[model samples]
Target: MIHGILNLPRNIWLIGLISLCNDSASEMLYPVIPLYLSSVLMAGPRALGIIEGIAEATASLLKLFSGVIMDRTRTAKPWIILGYSLAGFGRPLIALAGSWGWLLLIRFADRVGKGLRTSPRDALLASCAAPNQRGLAFGLHRAMDNAGAVIGPLLAFALLSREVPLAHIFLWAIVPALICLALSLKIRESAPAASAPKRVAFDWRLGDMPLVFKRYLVVVALFTLGNSSNMFLLLRAKEVGMPSEYVPLLWAAVSAVAMIFSIPLSALSDRVGRITVLVCGYTAYAIFYFGISATEKNTGALFLLFGLYGLFMGATEGVEKALVVDLVAEDRRGTAFGWFNLTTGLFLLPASVLFGFLYQGISPTCAFLFSGCCAIAAALLLIFFVANRRP
Candidate 1:
């Protein structure tokens, strides 16, 4: 089994394996962190918000620098390895947290690792894929990542069922981290071209990214302004009377569906147009949010809506990375991805905070309606400004 996986295309298989292990480690701890904070550590909503805010803030701040560093050094692999290793090791630190302060510190460390890794890893993935197959490559990576999402929670569930402590689950998660570390060593770095400069300045000017990519980035930021954390979505579902016991199952279902659809949808974008498939994805999100808003107490409908939500995620996540690669020059790929993530991550804080307020003040339905409207508006923008203009 190991040999078969190793014998597959090096880039694809390596990325997939790394994602599998990393996400397994992440998902094992992520779902329970808030609960642990509130229940065990006696933290409140404010603390939870602060933890998440700081974690994401750390990621946003590092991304631009990390990208510039990767491009200047013309080396992505070392950054990638370091970032994942930090994140992998950081998970166990959460298990040792005796207070919310300690948890926040650990979360910051983990996201800092994420910040360091993402842009460089994306650059490496782009380098590995054929131009035309970029969408499929990213999609496969996401699928494998979500596959770990599926497994991780299930592992958590089993461990919890066996009366295992949450801390132990986190500690045991290090096993996957070790696996990811081992796999990271196997991925040979893509050789840089002779034409590529040996050393570019670490200072990336705003002018370096093209006008089209900038415009697209604006639209993505607009869309992300309404796209908050999935934690809020779970909170909203529970607020509307969905039991806690069934929540993981809903998440698991979404991951399962996304895992199933990601590769095929990504491959479809390779044959069709990336933008076209992406617009469809945005439209699906709009419809899904609309369904969530309109349905008050229908559990059946909620499950169906969540399933479709998975499909939307499957279609867009990888394709978006492929589209970034399409829009930017090879040398500036790291910067492009960094800018993309930075913009989106910046918006998420306001979006999530606002959504929480909306859910608190008006209604959860209003929050869903707000999300749906933004998604549709984003879809329209993509149709007019992006998809139609692309060949």
Candidate 2:
């Protein structure tokens, strides 16, 4: 099995490994951040919203520029290296933060690294994989990604349960980050072939993207508008009376399900079609969110909802990236992915903030209901408007 993975292209496995390490590092920190803010820092829902909004907003603003810069320079490896290193260094800062403001700065720095690397890294992965196996490539990457998510949080649970300090957990994450950096250095760059022009004008425009890409972006934007921050999900679980100690276990369960399903769902998308898998995933999300809204304080119900949410994530996230590559030309994939991230991420701020307000003003259930409605609308739009248009 190890050799089989090794037989895959160096770039493919390397990207997977990098994702594994980075996500492990991230998962170790993310689930606890909101809890820490509320419990330790005395922040309210509004402050959590602001921190997430600012972090994602910073990431959104940088993606397009990062993609254009990577394309123009005909260099992806250096940026990838820098991005990962920056994110790795930034992770520890959260543990050291004295206030929500400091935590926001750390989150912003980390997201900046994500914005810089994501498009170029995805383009490189696409370039590395055989066209027929792009789904598998992305799926394997996501599986490995969530594998880290599983390990990181479980580790957090173990350490915290053993009376290990949060600062120690944060500092320890640097180990994986360093591993990722070392692995990244060994992965060969898959930059697009440079033409005789030496440098090309940065003429990539959001308006100039293909119609299919644009339509898909619209669908994603709509879905994301409802797909508020995961913090809300944790908060919902808490509201439903899940013990604070059990929250990480709940997250671990979600990651475990996502890890198991991602590769199979991605492979299924490869065999069937991406749209079929994505539409199904979106419909599942609609139902899952609706369930979250309608249900009361039942651990069984919350577990089931989280499991379903994981399935939806497994089916959609990596498969969506593969579809983006399929719809765009090889040479322009970096720009395409950048624009996609930019559009979706820019919407995340408003989504999270609005949901936070709804949760505070009306009820948590109301926020989830709103999200469910948006998802259902997006699913319907995709089914009616965009499903049959691909060719």
Clashing pairs in 2: none
Candidate 1's C-alpha lDDT?
Answer: 0.79
- Estimate, for each residue in 68-169, the C-alpha lDDT of model 2 and write its tens digit: 775566567887888899998889877788889998899999999988888888888887887778888888889999998888888777877787766677
Candidate with maximal lDDT? 2
Query: Stretches of candidate 2 above 4 Å error?
Result: 1-7, 190-205
- The 0-to-1 C-alpha lDDT of every candidate, in the order given, reads 0.79, 0.83
Q: Where does model 1 exceed 4 Å of error?
A: 1-8, 42-47, 197-205, 294-298
**lDDT at residue 331 of model 1 (Cα atoms):** 85
* TM-scores of all candidate predictions against the true structure: 0.91, 0.94
The prediction achieving the highest TM-score against the true structure is: 2
